[model samples]
Target: MKTSLAVASATVALAVLFPFAAAEAQQAKPQSWPGIKRTDLQRHDLSAPGREVIQVHVDFAPGAAVPAHSHPGEEIVYAIEGAMEYQVEGQSPVTLKSGDVLFIPAGAIHSVKNAGSGNAAELATYIVEKGKPLLVGK
Candidate 1:
């Protein structure tokens, strides 16, 4: 997939695992994310009409990856454990470690891989349109 992190990076100022995964979570079902584990900690409807923010916690097995995907919201990521290789379409891959931050724009295709010997985890905050799906697998 083209590394398109630039738009997402710029937009955070922008955009998870799959459409069904998000759908399942929304329905309060157990969510299964390929190559990773996730928890939607909270969803806050913004005061701005039609906007909302979601907090997600994710963990990837060492060397595991979430395939190319896009979202309908801007994602801001903060690394929590180990390291991750984040690539957005048309952009150079960025290695994010604990305490590092990244921005992803809505609808920008991207992929993330664990880049360390141990599992990697991150916190993602998404600002998105109300009622829109969180992820779309490519």
Candidate 2:
């Protein structure tokens, strides 16, 4: 009888603890923004200490936008196709077409949108500090 009672007590404890554990696991996952698809193309450590470079291919559906965000370091963007409008803090918004490029200074809050009728894409190369998140939403 005592063995059965201990098993029941343990089961009840687990039942009470499981939800909290599940919630913590969910919160530990990284946050993903909607309307944008990002594909990591490459990552390499830079010669400079604690610095790294990351290349990503980003695609935006028509009328889609990435909300204001900032990076740990510089961002060099090359528009691959369609039109994209970029708004950088302290600067006027600019629209870039295919083959156009833009530079964003580190920690400069900015956002981008697909301004064309169709999908737009860009190759984003980031020079950032190692072990830090690529983007921080504003």
Candidate 3:
């Protein structure tokens, strides 16, 4: 299942998760995710004063791979299309297809590659510190 990139507004839970809607604009900077297309969505402040939450849409080209990297904060990925072979530090690779959800702790080294012939997509949610970059290249 190849799902196109869909942009939706925030929800209550998402708002709660990412509370800084007031500073939504100009916060989500586009990222260069090798072999992938990334659409950065709204970024909001978390209930915690200095923390923030950001959401993004990522599409992996067939056989594409995202280089090993780490997030400054927690990352939650929900597979929306096709399948992906995902690996994290100290963990075996896992195949995540539609409906699969994976969580990566902050600073964990990881990478992902499309495991299917078609494209793959996922929703990535990040809970990070305010003004900090979301991803850190390893």
Against the true structure, whose lDDT is highest?
2
If scored against the real structure, what TM-score would every candidate get?
Answer: 0.76, 0.77, 0.75
- Kindly list the per-residue Cα lDDT of model 1 for residues 1-138, writing each as its tens digit: 235776665455212335544564654322444558887677779998999899989989877888788877899999998999999998999999999999998989998999999989999998988876677777
Off by more than 4 A, model 1: 1-22, 25-34
Write model 2 residue lDDT over 8-121, tens digit each, in one string. 998997798667544532442222445677766777899999999989898988988888888899999999999999999999999999999999999999989999999999
lDDT of 3 by residue, 31-112 (tens): 3444688766767788998898889899998978887878778999999999999999999999999999999998899989
User: In order, what is each prediction's RMSD in angstroms?
Assistant: 13.3, 11.7, 8.2
The lowest-lDDT stretch of 10 consecutive residues in candidate 3 is 1-10
Model 1, CA-based lDDT: 0.81
Off by over 4 Å in 3: 1-34
| Candidate 2: residue 63 Cα off by (Å) | 1.0
